[model samples]
Structures are given as C-alpha cells and as structure tokens.
Target: MSNSGTPPRRLSTGGQPPIKFLLHYVVEQVPSRNGRTPCFTAWLREELASGQITTWNDEPIRVEDTRPEFAIQVYDTTTPPSQDSGGDVDQRLQALAKALHAETRGEREGPPGRDRDRIDVWGLPLSADLSDEERIATCKAHLLAEIAARDGGETEFPIERIGNSFTFGRALYIIDRPPSRWDEGEGGILELLWDVNPGYRAMMVHEFGEKYETYEYEPIVTRVTRAELGNQWLMMRHGASR
Candidate 1:
C-alpha cells in the first residue's frame, strides 16, 4: 500500500549494471475481521514449504510496515546466464519482467466501491553476467513453471514468444502471448520496453479483447525487488494449483 500522494521510487538503472536477477513483489492488503494478517505471506509459506526466509536486499524480507499489507522478495539467480548461448538476453529478461508484472498486477476496470486486486511492477537492469543462451533458457524455464501453476498441471496453453525489437542498441522491445480464459479471443499479449541511455526507462503494455470487441490496453508502472520477484515466480510455480 503505497501512500496515495507519494509514488514509490523506481529502481536506479544507471550505475553497476545488474549482475544478478532480482524479483520484487507487492500485493494489496487482504481484510480480516480479527486483524490484518497478510494473505500473501501465508501463500508464500505454503509454496516454499517453510515459513523462514532470512534476507532481502541484504535485509530481512519480513519487516514491520504500516502500508502495503503484503510483500515478497527473492532472486532468480545469483550468477549470470552462460555466454556461449546465442539468444536475445534483453528480450528474455523483458519477457520475464513483463510476465511477472502481469501476474502480480493485471488490468482492472469496474464501478466504484468494488474491491479489486492490485499489484506493481519494477524494472531493473538485465544482469550482464548471463550469456544469451542462458538468459533465454532461464526465461523459458520460469515461464513453463508459471504456465504449469496456472493451468493446474495441464499445460494446454503453452507460453508463446511473439517477437522482439531492438532500437539503436539502446532500447529493447519484447512481446509474449500468455495463457488466458477469454472465450472470445485466443489469449493476451504482454509488451515490454527498456532503454539504457539517458537514464534507464521501462514500460509495460497489456492488450486483450473479445472476438467482436475492440482491444483494451493498459499501461503500468511500479517496481519490485529481487526477492519479491522470486516470490512471485515461486507463487506462480507452486501456488496456482493450490
């Protein structure tokens, strides 16, 4: 729960390019009668099969906070992907980041007074350590795990890579077709963009529509940490079936 007036800070992408992958996650506060106990925490406990996590961003992941009822932090990998691999590193990272963003926070539009789920997305620099092949493989592995979790062990709808674009060696674009249940259309598309120079920039665009209806697009901005990112990936990997 970020303050309405103060926007959460975006991660700085300038100095010390990412050498490791980190995932940051945030969940809206779940209400309870007795008191507020973050449901996200309970969900994480079930997925990890252990309630104990020692650190996040070099500090404890669990800390007291008045705002943002639920949060998670984790890392995808401490070492970079192998280099001998031939693949688009930026595209793969962008796809994972966009997918994570969509999973945690999707588009929502409804009348007033209606309760809805909210989540945020944070973009960090792609780790320079992993090789192109490694990055692509890592992204595919994570996506497969997520698809399995979402499809209840039935992966009828496989993750699809639409395409990607690179701009003047500074900007990167990635598109993905993820699983969906809309009877009117095939599935949803996630688009991600990243720029390195003149300060790092990241953006996400989600598009979906019914068969006869015009497509709907939503843009998002918010960031999470490595640990939180990891938590989301794990939840998608382990919690969806439960």
Candidate 2:
C-alpha cells in the first residue's frame, strides 16, 4: 500500500534517556495471479520512512521503511568508577532495550514449550484414518463445546463455516467474537483447518498485546502451515485445485 502523509520523525538519543521506539506497519494487498484470475496477496510493510534511525553509537541499524528486520542495540553506558555503582542503571537499560526489541520485532511473550500436544480439540486424533465428514463433524462439535465453556456461553462463539477447499483438501471454520468482548492480550478468535484427506487438524488463536499487532495466530499445533484461507479459496476457484 502507498504511504500517505508525512514520514515519521527520527528518534534522538542525545538525552541519554532510555528510548521507546514504536514501529508501525501497514497491511497491503498486492495483485497477483494464482492461475488465470487475479488475486490480492496481503503483506506487512513499514508505514513510514524518515522515522527510522539508521545508525546508533556508530553501529549500523538497518530499518527498511519502518520494519525492524535488523538487530538494535539501544543501551549505551560507559564504565562506572565502581562496579556496583552503575549496576542498577545497567540492569534498567538492559530491560528497556529488551522490551523495545520485542516490541519492534513483534515478538509474543508467552509460556515456553509447545502448546500443540494440549490441543485435543475433538477428543480424537485427527489422523488420516478418519473420513472428511467425520472430521468436520468432530471439529464442529469441539467448537460448540468450547463456546459453551467460555464466559458468554454459545453467544460468544459466532461460528462461521468458511466451507471446503478441494485444492488443499481441508474444511475451515472461524470462531469470531467482538473486539469489546475480547480480553487484552487474550486471543479473541480461533480458526480451525481440518484436512479432509489426511484428517490432520490445525488450529490457531488470534492474539493481541499492548506493543504489537500480529496477523499470525498462536498455533495449537506447530507443524501446521499458516495460510490465508480466503486467498487459498481464490486460488482454488481459479483452476489451481490441488
């Protein structure tokens, strides 16, 4: 997408105060052909150009527009007269730098280790043995149960059937809720992709936090490929059926 308005102003580190850098990205849709028909591919790009600081402490910090694709060293402290004297300042600067890095990189701070094993969505292994119809039924049932278990009950889960994709051999479902009802830092919605032929299931929960906005979901199963189902549908419709 084309940028509008003035480019952001560059950050100044002259004050020696800890800097908080905020990077914003615009989601753009670029036209491409999946086969014969034209489709739009969505991607994130830096929204501003001039706001980026190219060099800090004589070290090059690359910023493509506003995207933080490079490492940033934000801490600059000279040797203290005594080791213990500057300990507090060093620690504080380190923490601030870490936080800023996480924000710019759009990192999600969550519990370590994989959450996939805990995702027994349908109480059945989404194995290749199960039929497509059976998988779909199980997924729907699981979604219903999840909705009922939430705070707002079934009303909270506005399940939308996104239909089948013959190309990828999967059926999609979206559990959407209003932004108001969604708790801060909590995933507001769930998306399920059930492979029709292989019977493999992948699920993602959309999450948001104070510092960053991410389009990617927190996956229940790690190996499942992230996809834009809408784009996939367009591809399938345009004679790219798998």
Candidate 3:
C-alpha cells in the first residue's frame, strides 16, 4: 500500500501522461486475528483464487513459495488498469541484460542469510538444451530426494512447472513457487552441480540441500542466480543491507 496522505501523482491537470508502476512483493508474517487462517501462503491463495482482483497474464497471482499455490496466472483489467505495454518492453530488455551480465560474472554479488524456500533458475541453451518441462521435473525430483535425505525419510514437497520463453539463444524458465525451504547456498550448489556434470544437473538441488545456506562453493554454479540475490547484493554493497 502507498504511504498515507501521499496524493496520487497526476501527469496533467485533467489527464495524465502514460505511466507505469512497479509492484513490489514481500512475505510478512502477520498475527492471526482469532481463528482466522492457516499460513500466509494459504490465505494468499484463497485471495487470488477468489476472482476479486485481476492478474497480469490471465494467470493467477500468488504469494506461496510452493507449487500450484504459487503458480501465477495473469488477468487484465480495463478500469484503473495497468499502463500500456510499450513501457514493459524496455523494462524486460533491461532485465534481460542484467540477467546476462550476472550470469556471466560481470555482477557477482547477491543477498545473504535469506535462508527461506526460494527458487533460482538459469538457462544456458548450450548447457543441456533440456525442455522447460524436463528441467522442472528433473529439478523437482532432485529437490525431493534432497529433502528426503536431509529429513531422513520420505517427503513430498510441492513443485509446479511455471512457464518458459526463448530468448538470446536460450530458453528461459520461471519455476512457479519454489519450495519455501530453499536457500541461497543450496541454490548455488545446485547450479554448480548442474554446470559441471551434465548428467548430474538433475540432482544439484539435492546437493545444495545437504550443505550451506548462502555461499556459492563451486565455480560452475554461484549464488547470484536467485532473483532476490541481485537486490541483496546491491543493498549490502551500498551498506544498506536490511
């Protein structure tokens, strides 16, 4: 929500210039009022599925860090709606450039201690050329195995195959909602394991689950791949770590 008493900025007296807004999301634990709800993720899923709000791509917008529940579906609204699509094109371009740079090590920093279940995905078409579905399935299996091994028993963690796109000679993937237990250290090991041994990429998730929580210990895979990693790196580098 916007700050109180902060009047909406208008581009004109009676009309406004075309403007776009950035939506920021974060997970916050709220105190339940009475016997009101389950976890935050469960409550959010109900809100999104209720059809009370429009999504971006006719896909459900969610907050869960687990499968299906976190799978995003977008929808568009005409009234009080989003800005024109033109602006998003440039934004997407900038994002892609940043992603490429970070992947190549030009930008090598990321956030720390965010030991929550999060997801990071990297696409190097030449690495394995695996289809998005194959990647998700392979990764999910790997993660499940890791969870089982760590907990010392059988486990079933939610996993959802999000969506994919082809760009810059690579196939891009977005995992729906990653298991809430994933951390940066685990993400790094997974990336490295996949990068070094082509056949073992499928099991990298498990490797990470067995070790560190933030540092990237391998050259093949690093910690800068997580979506939230960049921002964290910036914050700490600038002495603004939160």
Candidate 4:
C-alpha cells in the first residue's frame, strides 16, 4: 500500500538531503508471452507483500495504484545512502517518493511541481485588534502567496463555479456570516465545497466488474477561521467572473 504518513509529510531536500528515486507505475494490457506461467500480476504481489520490494540491485517494489500488472519504476543511485534511523523510515520507499514527481507526455509543469502533490498551508498570528477588512487583507496576502507558490498549491486561474462544478483553482469565497448568530469579537468559521477536476486527460482503469472511465471529481473540504482568513480571501485576483 501507500505509506504517506500522518498530516502527510512534505518531502523536499531541505537538509541532510536524502537519496531520491522515482517509481513509474502503470499496469498495461498485454498478452502472455508463452501462455504458460501465471501472469506476473498474480504472484508478483505475493512476493512484494513477502518483503520483496525492489529488484534493481534487488530494489524492492510495492504496487498500490488500481492496476498491478505492469509498472515502470525508477530510482537515482547517484547519492550515497543516508544513515538508517533504526528502520523507522524505509529508505527504499523514501527513494521512490522522498521527492517523487511525474512528467506526463504533453502536460507542462506549474513550477517546482507537476509531477507531485503539494499542500499550501498558511499560518498567521496577527494582532487581535485588527478590523475585519484588515483580517481579509491578511487572508488575501496568504492566498496570493499560495497562488504564487512554486509547487502545486493555489493557481492564478479563476475559480469558476457553474451549478455544481467549481473550476480546479478557487476563485473567491463569498462569506455569509449571520450577524445574530455570533457575539462581537468572536471568531466564526467558513465551510467551502471544492469540486476538484484533476485534469483533462482520461485515464483508463478497472471499475466495478468492468472497465469504467471516470474523471477526477474529488471534492475536498477546508475550514478557515475568521482569524485565519486574514484580511484577504482565496478568490482569484483577476478574471474571476461568477
């Protein structure tokens, strides 16, 4: 399975840069060569589950995505192996995802990311006496920062909402705070519904009992306190119609 740790650890070569590698996973549809031995998909998993992850110089490989027939994984043997920390961190998996990324055939990368997933977290500890507009400004500054992030965070693209589908990048959040529902100086919360479109390309995979095509319509939930929203909002800067 996948080994993304709690709060999902961020993997960038900050300090004591660890050895990095890439695991290209893809299970294509191909016929057996001899029509004899069982397909690698059947028994290959057994071996992987049995503590056999790699084959490159005996590199142990683990398959987690839907398909498990054919996978193309990669690694960089350039950097020397870092010291093991009592086996808590699997160097092998680390090698695969320490800084794992993807470079599709025709898609252009955003900045420092495209081949990987990036989370944008903003922390603000402003003065308590700031006005609501000032707080909104703080939130806006944070949103702008996130939009300009080198990795995959918020994008400059507008967040267009039509009925149920919201454009991938958020536009702006319309705050509807009920005045009678809260006391003065008391912080409130904003709940946003984000309909995420992974991309335009179509990926074929197995579903139910047959092959079904599905687009990435993953809806994610995010909570922002009035204190955290700062003075600004997460709305797109320009071209944000509706």
Instruction: Report the lDDT of model 1 for residue 227.
Output: 27
Arrange candidates by TM-score, highest first: which order?
4, 2, 1, 3
The 10-residue segment with the lowest total lDDT in model 2: 113-122
TM-score of each: 0.21, 0.24, 0.20, 0.24
Instruction: List the candidates ranked by lDDT, beginning with the highest.
Output: 2, 4, 1, 3
lDDT of predicted model 4: 0.29
Residue-level lDDT tens digits of model 1 in 127-230: 65655445444443443444345454433222222112211111111122212321124222222222221111111122222321332222221232332333
Tens-digit per-residue lDDT, 121-207, candidate 3: 221112235453454445444434433443543333222222111001111123222224224443421221221222233244456
Count of residue pairs whose backbone atoms collide, per candidate: 24, 1, 14, 26
Whichever of 1 and 3 has more TM-score, that candidate is 1
For candidate 4, lDDT tens digit of each residue in 184-207? 343343333333323211222222
lDDT of 2: 0.30
lDDT of each: 0.28, 0.30, 0.27, 0.29
RMSD of each: 20.1, 22.2, 20.2, 21.2
Which residue segments of model 4 deviate by more than 4 Å? 1-50, 53-118, 149-168, 171-188, 191-242
TM-score of 2: 0.24
